[model samples]
Structures are given as structure tokens and as C-alpha cells.
Target: MTKDRSVYIRHIYDCIGWIKEYVQEGKEAFLQDRKTQDAVIRNLEVIGQAVKDLGTDSLTASHPETPWPQIAATRNFLAHQYLGVDLTLIWNIVEQHLPKIEQQIIAISNDEGIDLNAPNTPELP
Candidate 1:
């Protein structure tokens, strides 16, 4: 069955949270740990998938500042080019892109009246 838009919104929030949790030890720690790198990469892919699922047209129009297309593209890159993943690019994304995304997702959620912390799906680690 198809999901509600809020479900995808929550997924984006949760994935960002998971990425933040994985990188809590900071940049050097992240760069040194393959498992953390892998976790962040996987969460980014999930964020992309959730963004794609949320449907680009309306969401992009609503929040034009958000880079919906690039986020989805990142997901595609991660899925297809997993073997050649660039740690620097991923690190930059975590350090930079995600906060903006997290903010925009919050904006989208508030504007759309979706409670991210609501009891819908189980939270992922």
C-alpha cells in the first residue's frame, strides 16, 4: 500500500537523526570508522528515497529553497556507485547539507502539520 506523505516526512527526520547519531564522535572519528561511514551513507540513501517518495513537484514548489533534486540524485549515486563512494563528499554532506535539509524538513512538517514525533512507525537506529 502507498504511504501517507507524513510517513515519508517522518522517515526523512528519522534518517537525519540516525546520521547525526552516527557522527556524534565528530569528523575525524567518522573518517576513521568504516562502520560509521557506512551507516551515514545508508541513512543518506534512505533520506533520498524518502524525498523521492514524498514526490518532488509539489514539495519542491512548496519549499523551493530545499535541494530536492540533488538529494534524490545523491541517493541514486549512493545506490549505483556504492563501491566508489567518496568519503570527503559524504563528510561534507553530513557537515553541511544535512542541517539545511533537517531544517527544511521541519519547515515542511510544520507547514504541512505533520508531527514528526508522532506514533506511526518504529524508530530506526
Candidate 2:
């Protein structure tokens, strides 16, 4: 439904905001601390859940570049196998993949006529 899509889009926007915040102030610190690592992992889980909730149609049809499966799998691994989670791999995702994902979200929002600079936008968890 339209409401569901709106929620998913908001989640995507929130994830992008979190990524930006982490990159801006926490990137170096996150790379050095376990607590920061865990926090970022949690944020990734939130993003992954949002992506999963969007489903394949929303991801592939509406936002083709969003990597929904990988996001969902990451969420699963973090939630169901936390002990086996790899910080290095997570760090790599943050450093390499997040920027592209953010760009894609921004592009999708623009295409859909959503304003990225709007007031009172929700912050990412």
C-alpha cells in the first residue's frame, strides 16, 4: 500500500542520515571501538529490516539499486547469529557500500519528488 511504501522510504531516508552522521563524526571512532562497532551494527540492522520490509517488488521495481537481499541477510546474521558477526566485514560495508547506498536512496527520493532537505525529518536509529 501507499502508506507502507512511505514508511519504507522514510526508513531509507533515516538510514542515509545515520550513515552520514557516522561518516561525519563516528567513522574513525567506530573503527577503533567495539562499542561503536556494535552501535553501527545495530543501525545496519535497522536499515536491513527496513529494506526487508520493503520487499522485492519495492526494491527491484521501485528502487532497483537497493540491494534488498543483502540488507535482509545482514539483518538476519546480526539478529540470529550475533556471536558470529564479523566487525571487519561490517566496517567494510560502512566504508565501501554505505556511500553508494546513500546515493541511491537520495536518487530514489529525488525521482519520487521527495525533499531531502525538509524540516523535522526523522533521525536514523
Tens digit per residue, CA lDDT, model 2, 85-107: 77678878887888887787777
User: Scored by Cα lDDT, where does model 1 land?
Assistant: 0.91
How would you encode candidate 1's per-residue C-alpha lDDT over 1-125 as one tens digit per residue? 67888989998999899999999999999999999999999999999988888888777899999879889888999999878898999999999999999999999999989999986675465
Task: Give Cα distance to truth, residue 119, candidate 1, Å.
Answer: 2.8
TM-scores of all predicted structures: 0.93, 0.76
Candidate no. 1 TM-score: 0.93
List the candidate 2 regions with Cα displacement exceeding 4 Å.
Answer: 1-4, 23-28, 118-125
Q: How many backbone clashes does candidate 2 have?
A: 0
Off by over 4 Å in 1: 122-125
Evaluate all candidate structures by whole-model CA lDDT and list the values in order.
Answer: 0.91, 0.72
Model 1 / residue 25 / CA error / Å? 1.0
